[model samples]
Target: MNGVLKALALPVVLFTGWWVLSADSESFYAPPLSQILTAFGDTWTLEQLKADVLPSLLRLFAGFLLAALIGVAAGVAIGSSRRLRAVTEPVLEFFRAIPPPVLVPVIMLFAGIGDAMKVIVIVFGCVWPILLNTVEGVRAVDSVVLETARSYGVTGTARITRVILPSASPQIATGLRQALSIAIILMVISEMFAASNGLGFTIVQFQRSFAIPEMWSGIILLGLLGFGLSLLFRLAERRALRWYEGLRAAQRSS
Candidate 1:
């Protein structure tokens, strides 16, 4: 309860300030907070949610998941082999330097303005952080630990599951957290161009049509959605890294 309240304090204060500041605004572009909230409630119906919000969320999840899988897998391979890592480092850096949005047009040409294109854009944007972090994590694993695993006859899949993955999990979690925000940004950007059935598209539509309050509402929804996802990601990270946390606690106590 305390944590929830603390988390909400800033948003509550900001909302209160916004309400007071805009209470008497007469500008068409800057409607009162009350009007914006009213429009938010009125326009974002169940059907509208199904048509716009759900698809965007689905694409976000799909792209993020794909990025996570590929990043971790490739990171592990490259991290485990010095030759492979050396060979790929320049290529990885080159690709990572390119912005994800810039690739949308090229991806659209190949993927043809579909969900595939959006997901590809998101994955391209998100994968670099995760892959790089995971590589660093793997490389940072203690040599003694690797030797111990090897001595115990742990090889191949068993070694990865029992030794490598656990050791690098903390850094992997960090990468995932970073990638999630990137994924959300890419999701919206991908939807902005050549899209008709997403929250981003809806917001753009409202803006072009001069539905200011509705556009504001969509922006609010996006902020809330990002906040909610961050909260959920943190929860999952805590749960997944419980063992790592316990170890750190023990070390601190010592």
Candidate 2:
């Protein structure tokens, strides 16, 4: 309860302040909170949700999942072998340095302004953190564990599945958490660049038309969406890393 209250306190304070400050305001750009909420309630109908929200979520999930799979696989391969890591480190760094938004136009040229381009953009943006973290996690695994697994005749997939992945899961989870925010940002940026339908496009459309309240509503919805995804990810991470967390706690207690 205390934790919940602490979490709610800031939002409550901010909302109250916003309500009070905008109560008698007449700013065109910054519509009153009540008006924004009203517009939000009105514009976010079932159909709009299906059309805009669903597509954005689909792209987000599809791209993120792809990034996760590829990142983990590549990270494992590179991390487990010193030669491979040496060979790939510079290339990875170079690519990772490039801003994802810069690739949107180039990707669009190749993939066109379609779902493929958007997913590609998101995947490109999200893959680096997961890949880098997984590499670090794998490299950091205790050498004793690897030797033990090898002595037991464990090889290839068995070793990776039973030892490496489990040992590195905590770091992988961290990477995924980092990637989530990047994925969301890329999702919005991609839509803003060249798109017909999405939360980003909708917000931009409203802003262009000077529908200030509706634009604010879209922005609010995006923030809420990010918060909800974050909560869900945290819940999943807690479940997935339960053993790792328990081990740490035990060590601390000792």
Q: Least accurate stretch of 10 residues (summed lDDT) in model 1?
A: 1-10
lDDT of 2 at 67: 100
C-alpha RMSD in Å of predicted model 2 compared with the true structure: 1.3
- Whole-model lDDT, candidate 1? 0.95
Per-model TM-score versus the true fold:
0.97, 0.96
Give per-candidate clash totals. 0, 0
Where model 1 places Cα greater than 4 Å from the true spot, the runs are none
Error of 2 at 128 (Å): 0.2
Local distance difference test, each candidate: 0.95, 0.94
lDDT of 2 by residue, 1-254 (tens): 46446666887898899999998878888878999999999999999999999999999999999999999999999999999999999999999999999989899999999899999999999999999999999999999999999999999899999999999999999999999999999999999978999999999999999999999999989998997798779878888888988999999999
Best by TM-score: 1
The sequence of per-residue lDDT tens digits that candidate 1 reaches over residues 1-254 is 57667878998999999999999999999999999999999999999999999999999999999999999999999999999999999999999999999989999999999999999999999999999999999999999999998999999999998899899999999999999999888988999999989999999999999999999999999999998899889888888999988999999999
RMSD of each: 1.0, 1.3
Q: After best superposition, candidate 1 residue 32: deviation in angstroms?
A: 1.4
